[model samples]
Target: MPTLKINDVEVKVEPGTLLLDACAQAGFPVPSYCYHPTLTPVATCRMCVVEIKGQPKLATSCTTLAADGQEVFTESPAVKDGRAGVMEFLLINHPLDCPICDQAGECKLQDYSYQYGQDDSRMVEPKRRYRYEDLGAKIVIDKNRCIHCTRCVRFTKEISGTYELTVANRGSNLEVTTYAGRSMDENPLAGNVVDLCPVGALTSRDFRFNKRVWYLKPVPTINRHSPMANPMWADVDKNRVWRFRPRPQGTQVSTHYMFDEERLAWHRYDLDPAVRVATPVLRGAPASVEAVAAALREGATAVVGQGTFGCDSAQRLGDLASAPELRYGSGDRVVQIQFPALQLSSDGVLNRRGFSERGYRFGHLDELLAKVKGGEVRSVILLHDEAFSSRAEAAKLREIVEAAPFSLVLEPIPGELSGLATATLPVTTFLEEADFVIDHEGVLKRYQKALQAPKGVKTVAAWAKELAAATQAAHA
Candidate 1:
C-alpha cells in the first residue's frame, strides 16, 4: 500500500496507482478524455495534468504512477494555466457546433470546459474543417471535431477485434479512419466507437438528429440483450426510448462498453401509439386497470412469472399466484454460441435469476399445465414480453398458456400471447419502470424508470400489490 496526498487530502491506495485515479480517490477528478479503464492508458490528450511536489514540470496524471508520500496538487495556479492552454490548443481546429453535434449534453468537451476551461478562445486563424463522412450505416465520422484521443482506434483493434480503424498520416495531418476504403458495417461492435469518441467526432447514425441530448432523460437499467447482464443508461422522453449507453460501475472491474446491437435495441421499445394497448382490455373490449387486475386474480389459479422482469417486479408478481410452486417461468428460448468477449450475452432475459430465486420454475410449463388440467392449478398470471423468443419457443409457450384454465397476460406492449389471454394488462416496459436487477449470478443492482407510462398502464409491482390485497380479502 502507498499513501499519497492529493490537493491536501491523503488517501491510501495500492502501489503503482495512477496519480489521476489517486486524485479522484482523494475526491478531486481531473478532467480526462483519453483515459479509459478498459483500454491502454494514453495521455496524449494532456487533459489529466497535475502538479506534483518536487516535479519540475506538470505531469500527465494518467500515466504518472503515484509514489509513497507523493504530494500532488491538482488545483494549483500553474496546473490550471497549463490545463487552460491545452484546452485552447485542442479547440483551435475544433468546430463550435455543439447544437448539431450528437454528443451535445454528455460531451466531455462541454462538461470539462465548463469545469476547467476559459470562456473565450484567442485563436485568430481560420479553423480547420472536414466534411462528415459515413463510416457505415451504423457510425458517422466528423474528422474536424476529433481530438486525436485514439480511443476509438484502439477500441476497434483491441476490444472489438475488428482492427477497422487506424491513424493515417502524421502531426497536423493525422486523422483516424477506416483501413483504406473499408466501412464499419461488418463489425458487430461498431456503435461502441461513438461512445468512445471523447468529442462529436464519431456519432451513431440511428441517434443523430432524432432528438437533442438534453431533452432526453437517462434511466439506469439492466441490458436484457447481454449474458453478463450489464447495466445501461437508457435515455428517453415521453415513453419513447432514445438510446442505450454503458452505465459503468466505477473503475474496478471494467464494464466493456455496449455493442452496436445493444445500443440500437432502443428501437424495440419505441411504442407506436396505434400498436400500444393504451389501457387494460379483456377479450377485445376496453377495461379499467382495476377490472383487469380483478379478472386476473379471479382466473389465475396459477401464475407464470417471466425471467425478463426486474427483482422487485418478480417478487411482487410471484406473490400474485396461488402458491410459490404454482409460479412458472417462461421466456423465448435462445441458443447463442458466438459469444463475443464483450457483454454480448444472448440470454435475452436479464433478470432470469431474480424470477428463479422467487420459485418461478422454468422448463416446467408442461407440468404446470398438467396441474391446471387436474384442477390443482386454477389461474395463471403471466409476466411476458415477446422480444426474446423464436418461433418454435413461442409456439410451445402459446400451447402451454392456452391450456391453463384461467390465463392473464402482462405485456410492456401487446403481443399474440396478450391477444389470446383471458385478460390483458398493460405492464411497464423496461424504459418505463423503476426497479432493481438480478444478474445471472444473482447480483442485485437497482434501477429507476426513465419515462412515464402511457395513460392507464402501471408497473408490474403496482399491479401485483393491488392483486395481493384483493386476493387476501377474497380468501378471507
Candidate 2:
C-alpha cells in the first residue's frame, strides 16, 4: 500500500493504483475524457493534469501511479490552467453543435467545457468542417463535432479487436473512419463506439435525433437478451423505453459494453397497446381472473416456465404445478457470436440459473410432453417469452398444450403458445416488472420496473400468488 496526500487529505491505496483513482477515492474526482477504467490509459486528453509537490511540471494523473508519501494537488492554479488549456485545444476544431447534438445533456465534453474552458476562443482562423460520413448502417461519424480524442478509434482497435475504425489523415485534419471501403456493419459491438465518444462525433443511426437525452430518465436494469444479464440503463420517456445503454457495474469489464443486438432490443418493450392482452381470457374470449383460477384448480396442473424470466416468477409459477417434478424450463435461444470474450455464454437464456435454482428443470420438455400425452398431466400453465423460444421448442410446447385437457398461458405478448391455450392471462414484460435473476456467472442482479404495465396486466409472481389463493379458497 502507498500513502498519498491529495489536496491535504491523506489516503492509502494499493501500490499500482493510479493517482486519478486515488484522487477519486480521496473525494476529488479529476475530470477525464479518454480514461475508461477497462481501457489502457492513453492520457491524450490532458484534462486530469495535477500538480505534484516535487515535480517541475504538472503530470497527467490518469497515467501516474501513486507513490508512498507523495503529495498531489488537483485544485491548484497551475492544474486548473493546464485543464483549461487542454479544453481550449480540444474545442479549437470542435464545432458548436450542442444545441442539436444528441450527446448534449450527458456528454463529457459539454460538462468539461463548462467547468474548465475559457469563456471565448483565442483562435482567429476558420473552424475545420466536413460532411457527416456513414461508417455503416449502424453508426454515423460527424467530423465537425469531433474533438479527436480517439476514444472510438481505440475502442475498436483495443477492446472490440475489430480494427475496422482508424484515424485517417494527420494532426489538424485527423478524422476517425473505416478502412478503405469496409463498413462497420459486420462488427456486433459497433454501437459501443457511440457511447465511448466524449463528444457528438459518433452517433447511432437508430437513436440519432429520436429523443433528447434530458427528457429520457435512465432506469437501472439488466439486459435479458444476453445470458450474462449485463447491467444496463433503460432510457425511458412518457412510459416507453427509448434505448438501452451499458450501465457499468463498478469496475466489471463484462458490464462495460453490450452487443448491438441487445442495445436495440429496447424496441421490443415499446409494445403497441392495442395488440397486448390486457385481461384474462378463456378460449380466446375475455374472462375474469377467478374463472381462470377455477379452470387451473380443476385439473392436474403443471408449469413450463421460460428460463429468461426472474427467479421470483419461476418460484411462484412452480407452486401452481400439481407436483414439484412438473415444473419445467423452456428457452433454447442461443446467440452465436464470433467474439467469445464479450459474451459470457452462447445460451441466450438470461435466467437459467434462477429457474434451475427454483427447481425448474431444463431439457426435459420432451418428457413433460410425453407425460401430458399419457394423460398423467391434465392441465398446463406456461410462462413464455416469444423472443427466447425457438421454432422447435414452440412446436413441442404447442403440442403439449393441445394434448392437455386444459392449458393456461401467462405471456407478455400473445404468441403461438398463448393462442393454443384454453385460458390466457396477460403478464407484465421485464421492463414493466421488478424482479431479480441469477446470471451466467452466478451473480444476482435485480431490475426495477421501467414502464407501466397495461391495465389488468400483472407480473407472473403476482398472478401465481392470486391463483394459489383462489385454488385454496375453492378447495376450502
256 in model 1: Cα distance from truth in Å?
4.5
TM per prediction: 0.90, 0.97
Task: Report how far residue 3 has shifted in candidate 1, in Å.
Answer: 2.3
Candidate 2 residue-wise lDDT, 365-414, digit = tens: 99998898888888999999889989999889888889999999888867
lDDT of 1 by residue, 1-476 (tens): 99988888989998878888888888998899999887888898998999988989999999999899999999999999998888888989988899788889889998888878899989898987765556878888899999999999888777777788899888888888778778999887788888888898988888889888888878777776765678788887776788898888775333657767777888887877666676667767987656665665654367777777788888888887766678778875463644355544557677778888888888887887678777676667778777776777678668766876667788886789987887777777877777877876667877777777777678988878877776666667
For each of the candidates, give the backbone clash count.
8, 0
Every candidate's CA RMSD: 2.9, 1.3
> Which structure among the candidates has the greatest TM-score?
2
Model 1 bad stretches (over 4 Å): 114-122, 252-256, 273-275, 287-300, 332-341, 344-346, 372-378, 468-476
